[model samples]
Target: MTTLEDVLALVAIDSVSTNESALAKYVYEHLIVNSDLEVERIGDNVIARSVGLHSFRVLVAGHLDTVPGDVTASVIEGDVLHGLGACDMKGSLAGMIDLALDKTPRPVEVTWVFYAREEISRSQSGLLEIAELRPDLLVADVAVLAEPTGGRVEAGCQGTLRIKITLGGARAHTARPFTGRNAIHRLGDLLSFVALYQPREVQLEGVTYVEQLQAVSVEGGVAPNVVPDVASCVLNHRVAPDRTLDQAVQWLRDFLGELLDEQDVVEVKDWAPSASPELMNPHLTRLVEISGETPQAKVGWTDVATFREFGIPATNFGAGDPLRAHRSDEYVTTDEVNRFASVLGEWLRSTPNTSGTSI
Candidate 1:
């Protein structure tokens, strides 16, 4: 008999972004054969809902894929597990699987979603596809996204917009630099602005979301000996959730208006909206109480924003140090996974008649 630990150890399987077929199938098949839950598969995403007597449906979700890496999951000191996606969030997925196998009566209707390509972008994310394919499963009073939070309740997220800016100038041999205007120099000006620019911090719903502008990458000259004819840089802006995507883009353009003109191209390559704390909502409040933790703003863009767009209040809470996410040394403790499972499982098991917070 394969215990939940056996299944969790399957984190050893490689499920890099856009390659969640194996893991998705594993979750889909397990739900179908082992439980009476309503299970459905849409593309590489799996949706399973517990058939229980409850007024509110709690959505527990974790992404199925992680960035490319080949570290095999391994046990360390009988408590810690180290691997490519361990802290980046395979641990959260493991906890979800544990709850999915629970045989106890759930106080709230519970839905488990194993999504694909979350490490990609919101447009390609399986969560978005599931919303379009089956909005029925998306409906819930409140939701929890298992993003790495080191076990605290991280509410909401900052919106993100990646803009590609192109600067043009004449190309000439470095020996006669006076014959050409250096486009790379123009990029330097943009970098200077971003380097000195101060980020904004806004307090919303008892949490503060800090906004930032940063240059993630830069590309320019084909050869070192020649003055660059074109230079392009990708700048990512993380805006407070209070600002919409359109609002963030417009702000970016206006902020760079003096240096970048009509001829210079500035395009939004990607964007994702922010989620609100909705801290006062009963469901989120219950999670906070059960976890015995305070609220913090989720700085990174996450699926919590997807559920927020659907009018369902959402928050992020998971096991392990969030800072360890996506690193080569990614790891988590079995103790942490069990603690997460115990807290959330206890909340699910509490009946409406027992706790006013049941949902």
Candidate 2:
């Protein structure tokens, strides 16, 4: 059976994005063992539900995959459980599984989703797949993503955009650099623009969000001996909810227009638009009150946006620091896990009907 110890044991195995079969199997059996919930299996995605005719249902979700690579035990150190999947969501998964085990006979139905392939591209997200196949299954009064929020409710998420700015110039021998237009030298102006660009801070639904723009990568030069003819830079933008993906892309096009060729280099590499904090809902607010913590807007992108895309309200609340996730010293406090489990368990047990009433 999957106990708290079992959860820690699951974390010990490297289930990084590609190898989630073991972890998925573990969850599949764990859910089956505790309740007579209807179960469905697809790839490494596991869905188990307690049937009910309640006016509303609740969905609990956590990703089963982590980033690639493994962290040795020496790196984990003491109680920190330093490993790849320790914080990003394995701990959350453990908490949710524990929640599932402590089932109730209440009228409110509960759904547990343990999905795969969250670290890679969104198109490949396991949640997206379920969103298509069983939209109704995901339909709920509220959704909670146990995505390492340090036990506080985190609403919404920032959008992300990656674009390449290409600079063109003439090539010549380095010894006679003046003979060539320095493409790399042209990038200096763009770099300065990036260095001085101040991201905007926008407020929405009582939450403040910060936008960020940065030059994440640069590539150029055929050789040190030759003045490069082509140079390109990668820009990463964390946009606020005020803008759409289209607007964000257009903004970048305008920002890099001076350095980029109008004809040869206008294309989007990858863009994930942001989501707004939907905490205006009374039920969501009550959840915050019950947790006894002020909610914050998540600065990073997460599957909360996916649930939002379905028009379902979602929040991030889990037991560890997101900063610790994916780091060599990744770990979650056992106290946090116990507290998270208790808080979530109590909330699940006490969430009154939010249909026509003010919860």
Number of the predicted model whose TM-score against the real structure is largest: 2
In model 1, how large is the Cα lDDT of residue 21? 91
Q: After superposition, how far is residue 214 of candidate 2 from its true place, in Å?
A: 2.0
**Ten consecutive residues with minimal summed lDDT in candidate 2?**
71-80
What is the C-alpha lDDT profile of model 2 across 234-350, one tens digit per residue?
Answer: 888998878998888888777766666653364568888677787877656767877888888888898888888887788888888888877776777666677677777777877
- Tens-place lDDT per residue, model 1, 107-128, is 6889898999999756798998
Model 1 global lDDT (CA atoms, 0 to 1): 0.82
- The lDDT, on a scale of 0 to 1, for candidate 2 is 0.79
lDDT of candidates 1 onward, in order: 0.82, 0.79
Off by over 4 Å in 1: 1-8, 170-176, 222-229, 350-359
Candidate 1, residue 236: the lDDT equals 92
True-structure RMSD for candidate 2: 2.7
